[model samples]
Target: MSIQSGQSAIEILGPEQPESAAILSAQALQLVEELAERFNVRRDELLQLRLEKQAQIDNGKLPDFLPETASIRNSDWQILGIPADLQDRRVEITGPVERKMVINALNADVKVFMADFEDSLAPAWDKVVQGQANLRDAIRREIDFTHPTTGKSYALRPDPAVLIARVRGLHLDEVHLHWQGRPIAGALVDFGLYFFHNYQQLLDNGSGPYFYVPKLQSHLEARWWAEVFAYTEERFGLQPGTIKATCLIETLPAVFEMDEILYELRNNIVGLNCGRWDYIFSYIKTLRNHSDRVLPDRQAVTMEKPFLNAYSRLLIRTCHRRGALAMGGMAAFIPAKDPAKQEWVLNKVHADKELEAKNGHDGTWVAHPGLADTAMAVMDQYIGELPNQMAISRDSDAPISAQELLEPCQGEATEAGMRANIRIAVQYIEAWISGNGCVPIYGLMEDAATAEISRASIWQWIKHGTHLDNGQLVTVQLFEKMLLEELVTVREELGEARYENGRFGEASELFRSLTSAKELTDFLTLPGYQILTQKTVA
Candidate 1:
């Protein structure tokens, strides 16, 4: 356990663990220690606030915009202008921070590349440290890789995409790096190490340190980041606005507090993104106890749905009204092996991007490099040389209410949905356990958050006794039956040799553990993290 330091305390459950000494050098450790000793308490307090809020929600308290911050919402205010590099971000590509991925994402023909250390990464100790090293090399244009067998060498372009590093959320901890026998917050470790090492180098190359803040739940969390940025800039002798960030309004509560969230980080924030998958997971978790709020099949939740549309429009309205870019959601579809299927998927992505562009989104996200051009072309058609579509009036007439945003999708749960939830959850968890956070499953790039959605949806359905359109109820017996069937399908798909070698059995157990719990688990990765670190897959 951590010893008390004045008012701050961080306790480590286990004894000191060792990993990643390169990124945990004396100087980097000092910076991380400073952040942990100062802000870990506040982080804990905010997390406690989350629990309290969940309790209120469990008791049937529907989330709404704060009455106290109503004036802030109604007031006309804008974030400080963004750096020039970020101005025309029509399309942004995102991926894990492996060396090859870093190089490819930077060299891709996109406006920005989000080097993700969060959802798309498994966050093993080596990955955490090496991902930092990878980003540093990419920033310096020193990153390169040669395919082991293909004899093909890859390098960065002369003008790579603008880089934005996304650190982990506040709930995670870097157990490998400890300060005075206590683990530091993973967010601090990730953002601090990257910022401490590469802030100046990025600025020297004509871009500053930009970020995508993930999984923020309220304005207070945004305020915490603002304080961190202020301290970091002052500590590193950079200008106050040297760091620009885009917050992902991924949580249901955050959707309500969008304006307030931007207000807290007003000077440093440049945009807000729609974290569609995590938002759905959060929605399910938030309303898990409320039978009336149960959602339909995962495929049934589309952007055109009422709740999602309301959320997206409200985000655009909020960001544009504040002079911040309102970025669109991720196009998760990857290319299928068949050319016809790939073309169909690309066209679907084009339509999605077109809707976003027409709806006044300044930028959008794509998971694969192949879709970047498709997304950008759609944006080009709608935006037409403008950096963003914020000047277009998008939300003046169609005002959204809290009820509209909270309104659940009207569709029946089906056996297909349940089977898909099981199959996807098991496959994703298996891949995740193998240290891959993002996998192209059924031509869509799925991360741990998608697995969360699957398991949480299953849990909610079983808990609420949701009935399918075909008149079958979502019960434990039915779920178990579907899970067994999906397991057989997964085995056959992977082939016997590969199935036995991978972590499918363990993944199935993990998925069952997550969904069959009496209480909703907070994060699918939390328990899986232990499994990942403890064992090595063959």
Candidate 2:
């Protein structure tokens, strides 16, 4: 048997047995000597590994349990393989009961969809295998998602966004668990083994997984994942580069180690996502509060200007350096209601497209499928066509360098696009207050956390760039000037009038309304607004 530190051992009856046996006996002696030299210095690791090998053999499993490890290789972190452009792609998920959403999204031409087993699912532990069972039984034979016992059927069937983990060949799904949420080094090998087999099944379907690795802490974390990934070749008998991974740089630590993360997982890397809401929370909770940095209100400090600019630029550079696709984060949901709200969602999507396209991102996520058309339309609008090295053009006379066309699109988007998006964002905000969701944002979605997400959407846009509207771009300077001239007065007048009788339910309802509005205005009231005005004048 093979052993660590390059050693082996065996025994025989006599030194003068058959020729082969004697030769084997001598080789066994040589192996013992090597083992003595290598493992003699160590007591437990060598002995324990041997014992595990014995157990595997006795159970008719592994003939040899060799350690599969490797250092990082190939520095290609181009996130270009993403299914859609970062700014415009709609990535709605089907809940355990939401399969139809996937078809609906597809019918509308959304860029991507996920069958979520993480947050959207409540997979019971005892029935842990059920999740994979549901996926496999459905993937292979197309079983109904109806709970036979309950006689209740799911409206939407599961759609695999990343590969379905543990579904032979669907292992990349587990990347999110290991890389994203939290780091646990040892459990990773187990996870890798479980997913490797899934890749085989994925190949059967003529598709391979494109994973989203969540919550990566640093370049080191990405590196470790790469190491485990290398072992998959042996685990499932696949080519070296068959599997792929994309890290979600959500945590604060990950932001600092972008280059490392990109460098380490470069070969297998897809692209990085702009995880705004969670990232902001981490930015506030980990960097500011945890580190004892006194901060203003969370909502007040829009991550638009210097922060998002620097961060996004870094992401763009990192991806471009390796020719990987760099994706922008989600534009959250814009509740549609008024014409103004429609305009706001349109503005945000287009502006997001502007920022991403300008920064070199290829794709982004749209949270709500109902709003998929708006996001997809924005992407369709901005992405004139994929970059082609050979000569190609929509109009021969209007030809321009691809770089030239996308150059000015970097910072701010068109004015018309911005105005339209802003209206949609406003409409999204109005939805909770006045739209169709069961709860009003200001009315019911009053939790500080939910309210904060709503607030950040608007402030972030204004802070980053002046949004666009039907041929009019609202530059930050113009937006600021307008706030000085008109928006702030309206806000103050409304805040005072509303807060005069702002009881618990009243304030809560206001927050609920904010969610429905799909605009950040109402949430920008209360504590969040003060934080913005106090120190973020820039």
Candidate 3:
């Protein structure tokens, strides 16, 4: 199928769906094609710069504040004023754009709901188009869902949470949509479709189009987005800053350039979020070649770790000083069924939010609706009736240095941790390839970021030949042994019929290849997308 965009055509490789016409209309395709043609070359350049920077890190140069951007960092500047709907974001819930998940997330008692098309979504072609339709219906108050099995019904409440759409990262490509004989940037397709279809309705309802930009590695990337926003606003004859964005400071190099990033998008950005899970993954990937910087078990690297704590504190300081909201990280724990276990989960969430609140964060993210109240209560206690804690600049605190932000966490990898990593990565990858992304596993919400950490940590450990706490050395042979044992354990946990029906074989093979490769794979999704596309074709 092909759609005309001016004189050009966008070739659609995926099977057509009922919502395809409405979401992928000629006008929307035009916007996507224009954005891709104008900005994709710069996106390619920035991605190449990432590899160059990684080469420097591999050669022993640690990341630090840029000397060139010192003027912007030292000079006083502020992001444009945040809109009223986004002011009281004490608690925000996030999920994929599946129909039921969309309805439930928006109706939850939170200040905002980030409808994600990025990490939490599997990005199947049908799901991607259907997700756009779902969000458009939701914005117009026409979306509802009926459970296929339980016969339950769901509809949006009277005043739903504020909606923010997160587009895909620069590194991903929407292979199903080709422009000029190449795949369009996934980021453009997500942003262009959502913005084109819903901006007017959102503005009519007194909320302009809002967004969450993910996986950026530099200020130049931020500038690329800023230019896109400016061009879109001008094209639509809307006011400048009509599209407010909150960028995720998830990459290790981005932490050092927070001020610069905010400055580049100052007119269109409202805040910066601590995308902690991806940040940890970035920590490992950026320092994969540094023997002394090896991290311990994933569980051991908590927010209280010196490097993570320094990152949080510095983000708070920098954002508050520059008049941008400093949002906290995710509370990934899902409530357990058992009463005692549920209490323990809530307590962990409470403690985590308390740390973020005390450190002067204006908001936090929760993966489950069950967690929203707990996160909100903690933020309320610290912020009182205030919309946010922006007034608390943390000016009196000691400056966080590069060494602290890069501090090597002190702990040893355990056999249990390694086993758990193998299990989670395999199971999550299986689910992802099966067209589900947000999954509940072992009482935690597991998404692409956590799965990346799981596999990447093991790769880093094996690459460095580190010793586990059990006095076992990490090697390809040991990893393979554990892989087989873990599969057996998983097979027993899940019955034979279910195991046979699932995609564990493919998942395990992919995981094994990733962890045993000569160098760490940048993202498992890069390879996993191939499997997904092949499965779709078959």
Report backbone clashes per prediction: 0, 94, 0
Candidate 3 lDDT over 239-347, as tens digits, reads 9999999999999999999999999999999999999999999999999999999999999999999999999999999999988899999999998999999999999
What residue runs in model 2 are displaced by over 4 Å at the alpha carbon?
Answer: 1-108, 118-130, 137-197, 289-303, 337-343, 387-538
lDDT tens readout by residue for model 2, 253-346: 5665665676677666766766655555444333221212212333333335455555666665555555555666755444567788767767
Off by over 4 Å in 1: 1-22, 535-538
Could you give me the TM-score of model 3 versus the true structure? 0.99
For all the candidates, what are their Cα RMSDs to the real structure?
A: 3.3, 19.0, 1.2
List TM-scores for all candidates, in order: 0.95, 0.50, 0.99
Better of 1 and 3 by TM-score: 3
Kindly indicate the candidate among 2 and 3 with the higher lDDT. 3
Worst-scoring 10-residue span by lDDT in model 2: 167-176
- What is candidate 3's local distance difference test score? 0.93
lDDT for each candidate structure = 0.86, 0.41, 0.93
Query: Residue-wise lDDT of candidate 1 within 1-538, one digit each (tens)?
Result: 4323222233323333243444445666667778887788899899999999999999989998899888998888888788999999999999999989998998888999999999999987667778998888888888999999998999988989999999999998777555666567889988888988888898998899999999999999999999999998899898888999999999999999999989899889999999999999999999889888999988889888899988988899888888899999999998788989988998899888987887789999999998888998899888886888889656565789999999978887888888888998999999887889989887789997888999999899889888888898888778888888899999998899989999998999988878888899999889888887763211
- TM-score leader: 3
Stretches > 4 Å off in candidate 3 = 1-8, 535-538
